[model samples]
Target chain A: MSKKVKIVAATGCPTGIAHTFMAEEALKRAAEKLGVEIKVETHGQVGVQNQLTKEEIRAADGVIVAADKDVDAGRFKGKPTVDVSVSAGIKEAEHLIQQIIDGKARPYKGNSNAESKQEESSEGKSAGGFGRAIYKHLMNGVSHMLPFVVGGGVLIALSFLFGIHSANPDHESYNEFAAFLNSTGGVAFGLMVPILAAFIGQSIAQRPGMVAGFVGGMMANTGGAGFLGGIVAGFIAGYIILLLMKLLKGLPRTLDGLKAIFLYPLFGIFLTGAAMYFVVEPMTTINEAMMSFLSNFQDANPILLGLIVGSMSALDMGGPVNKAAYLTGTALLSDGNFFFMAGVSAACITPPLITAFATVFFRKFFNEQERNAGLVNFILGSTHITEGAIPFAAKNPIVVIPILMVGSSISAILTYIFSVQVPAPHGGFLVLPVVTNGVLWVVAILIGSLVGGFIYGMYQKYSYQKTK
Target chain B: MELLNKNLIKMHTNFQTQEEVFEGIASLAVEQGLASDKKTVVAGLANREKESTTGFFDGFAIPHTKNSAIQKAGIVIMVNESGLEWNSMDGQPAKFFISLLIPENEAGTTHLTLLAAVSRMLVHEDIRAKLLTLENEEKIYEEIKRFLSENM
Candidate 1:
């Protein structure tokens, strides 16, 4: 028999979470069945494991690198290599292996030591479509930004427990402990935009994209453009750096070092700053216009305004639409309009709670695994995590999403009609003391959850049975 | 391991139905002493199929099982040049059949790995195209061996 085909692979992700190990396992499993000898190196949160030796790299037929972050591909310069996203490693390991086997993979020609080499050119193309790439980059930024928002929002809420004036340094009621909490929380919140832009840039242009991205984010903050502006700035910074890299490809080898350190950042920061000033400045106006429109709703029937905002919050269950509603509310919070956020919070908390209630009331509609997931939604919903409803909606979107939207809308309407105002941007029942009308907010949430759950249960029972 | 030799493979098989193809491979395994109790093995495979179809998008099916009747972990491959009806997820009929038999206790990691390997290999268009051209049993076995050893 001929000699065995040998292959080496690497896997990594931004969070070093489940995807990294999952891809490694998938590659190993695929290799075994194909009767190919293979070794996998995983770069996880705990650090690198099963490091590939130089001998193994030289002897391998090909290399496969599945990573979300930048992975050094210089070691396999002469070898055929296929680079793909971590998800592709899990879903299409066999296809990738076959590409190597068929001699369809490209040779790695990237200079690993050169920081100025256009990182995009040497990198493997993303396996997903354009839409998927955009979504992935956006999520990368959002995931990194969440800790700052949550920590800061919670601390600020805690400070309010000592009396709202306790955080104001000029107020006679100012307490030292409350001031400390407020200041620390303010610092975390201050980092939120910059971190979001930096990661988004990192996702697009690798390490070099981060500097311009952070600068753009800071500009957005200074410009008063908020979250929406941060997103635009991130994309701008990433693409600008990517464009500069491509443009500077013909530079002399001796000057390669200058392109990354001197040229890219200098031009990147200048262009991104210009874009933030000229282009992104207009977004702040749009944001102000949106906030004003929401504020004007106070005069145009509270119930209708509540219905619109509430339904939007639950529309995608923490997806783009939901984030848009929450963003509007948060932006308005800085404008000193807390009533809109009160409606948003109420809407956000109802979907998962309603789903949990449905699972208990209509157990026959859900499978064992789904019922267990439903139970966990109680905690998630109580914490204002609308994403807890995603699993249920994904399974039967036709029935579940409409129910959630309607229920959340009812909650928002009730909260608005009661004139409830929430000063903080986040925190479910945990920040009840800070709400202007806490008891009514609870009443609205419960009513909405019960109505929504009852509707969902009945629909599942009747519709599913008919289909069967 | 000569687990996949001439005895475990049939080229240009004429079976018109999945059931006929499965039964043919099961009997061959029993005849080759790779498995015991052909009836039990066939039934176990059918039960596994009931849970989920093994048919993949690239015109191949891998129906595998671990059963008490399987005395060893082995694979039986059959090629149907004309292709046969299969309820594949991608709605493609299966042309290459790779059926596996493993001892019940050995069906954990090793069995799954082997199954994954075979499934992934057959999913590739180039490999599937190459597989369809080889007409003789020896050539088919050689191809399988080469694929298992070299192009994983």
Candidate 2:
């Protein structure tokens, strides 16, 4: 017989919670039962422990990596690995080990031919599929945008706090702290559009699209376009640069370098910005008008508005629908409409609350680790981080969707009934006083959110048990 | 090592239920003269699986054993037209079964090489789909060979 081979593996879920260690344990038990000598390397939040050395990887027959997040696969590039989601490792550890022993797993091959073949089979990017790709690109822009927003917003708030508006020119105070804060904030704000554009362009057409994309994003921002416009401008900049490159493909080889740095970027930025200004702006204005018209329910029925906003807010959990409801609430902040603010506040925490309730009431639908994560999600939800429910939602959308919707709706209705109000954009218990009828508002949200969460949790539990 | 090349594929639609998976696969093995008795080989594979589940996380089963009951070392790939339960890792039932028969003294590391190839391709949804199109034994052999030659 061929020499008996052995393999070791490390398995983990994101959050470095119990599942990470549980998967590790499962792999170890499976390997031992299979009569193979295996070593596992676990890298977790507590830090990398029991790491596999170079000698171990070189000597090993194969590797099994069941992870949820992006783990650096570079270490075991040439090694045979079975990439699986972390739950698989926990639930089917032995099978995974056996499969490895039988040779059913390996690392991804990165050759050009395979990549092109993969791309072709994937249908060259479907329409709705672009959401995730766009989201990734937008995340880079958002990450960069945050620093500017925080600095600029804080400075603007301070301008309200300390800056003087004098009837007489002599009475105004030029505060150094405010000036410095405002100036730095302005610089940060100036870079926001450019940085957003550059990254999006990079995502679309690589480095060549950066200049054009930046210019387009800036134009969109300056032309009264918002975050949505930045996204459009980014795409415009990237594709426009690509078109330019295609048109100039026949250029002499000697001018390639110059074309890359100067000609491509300069012309790309100018053309894309000019096109977006003349073409995209009018379209964007129309789109905004539609959105605003839809958002205009000033004297309309409160209950109907609450239901629409709440349901849409929970539909996709931070998607366009969710953003629509949120923006509507923020707009009301300007009008001192506390009812809208209350509705938004209630909607914001419902997702996480429902998720947490699922874990508590319907323990069967979720694994042990998910239940643990749910607890953390509860605290996060109250703090207005509705995104905490994303993982669970992605995993079990059918159940999560209805649960969140019901929960958000209940919260929204309660907010409207109580005539609750919040002055600030977001925050929970800490910022409660800025809200109208602070005590009653908090009570309504707590009771409504709890009811929603409890119902979802119970339903999830029943469904989970039935499946098992 | 005897089944080192992509020649030991056994595809049939009659293996509808989990109970008949071993029977259908063993029947093909006997017809090819890879093994004389279908029952013996099936029993051996079942016994090995009883010791531990053959399921993998990515929805795969590599049911195999070191039993010397077979005449030649061979790998028999059986694709179920409809997905069935093989007690998979993700708690989803497995749809594909790669039954490998390594000789008592297998030649070189051919078994390891072939296993690695199959496992690597399982991750590719395209390759998996192409494998599912094999309606008969000949098609199975042809598709697997083409995939290996192009992919491996």
Task: Kindly list the per-residue Cα lDDT of model 2 for residues A1-468, writing each as its tens digit.
Answer: 456566757655443423455567667767778877788766544445577878888888887777765555556666777666666776677887887788766554321112222232234343545454555555555555545544453454344344332112354656666566556655666566667667777766667676777778777666645444566777787767667766775777568678778888888878887887874457445545535754776445767766766676676554455666677777778887767867777777777777777687766566545676678766657656565565455444566677677778777777787777777666554466466788876676667667777877677667655644
Off by over 4 Å in 1: A1-72, A84-94, A101-103, A109-128, A291-297, A308-409, A418-438, A445-468, B1-152
Q: Write the per-residue lDDT of candidate 1 for residues A1-468, one digit (tens) a residue.
A: 298889999988654434566578778878987888889987755467789999999999999988877666767776888877776786688888888888877776454222222233334244434645565577678667756755665576577667666877898879999989878977887777788788888878776678999999898766666555677788899889878876776776677678778988899999988988975556546545655555566445778988888877887553345666788888788999898899999999999889889899998776545576678777667667675665466444556788999999999999989999899776577678778989999999999998999998898789657644
Model 1: per-residue Cα lDDT over B1-152, one tens digit each: 34567888887778887778878888989999988888888887777665446666567777777689888778898887677766664567887888877777662454445443555466455777887777788888777777767754
List the TM-score for candidate 2's chain B: 0.73
Q: For each predicted model, how many residue pairs clash, with residues at least 3 apart or on different chains?
A: 2, 8
In order of appearance, the predictions have TM-scores of 0.51, 0.40
Query: What is the TM-score of candidate 1?
Result: 0.51
Superposing all C-alpha atoms, what RMSD in Å does each candidate have to the true structure? Answer: 13.0, 18.3
TM-score of chain A of each: 0.62, 0.47
Residue A90, candidate 1: alpha-carbon lDDT:
67
DockQ, prediction 2: 0.03
The best candidate in terms of lDDT? 1
The regions of model 2 sitting more than 4 angstroms off are A1-198, A218-226, A278-296, A308-337, A348-410, A423-426, A433-468, B1-152
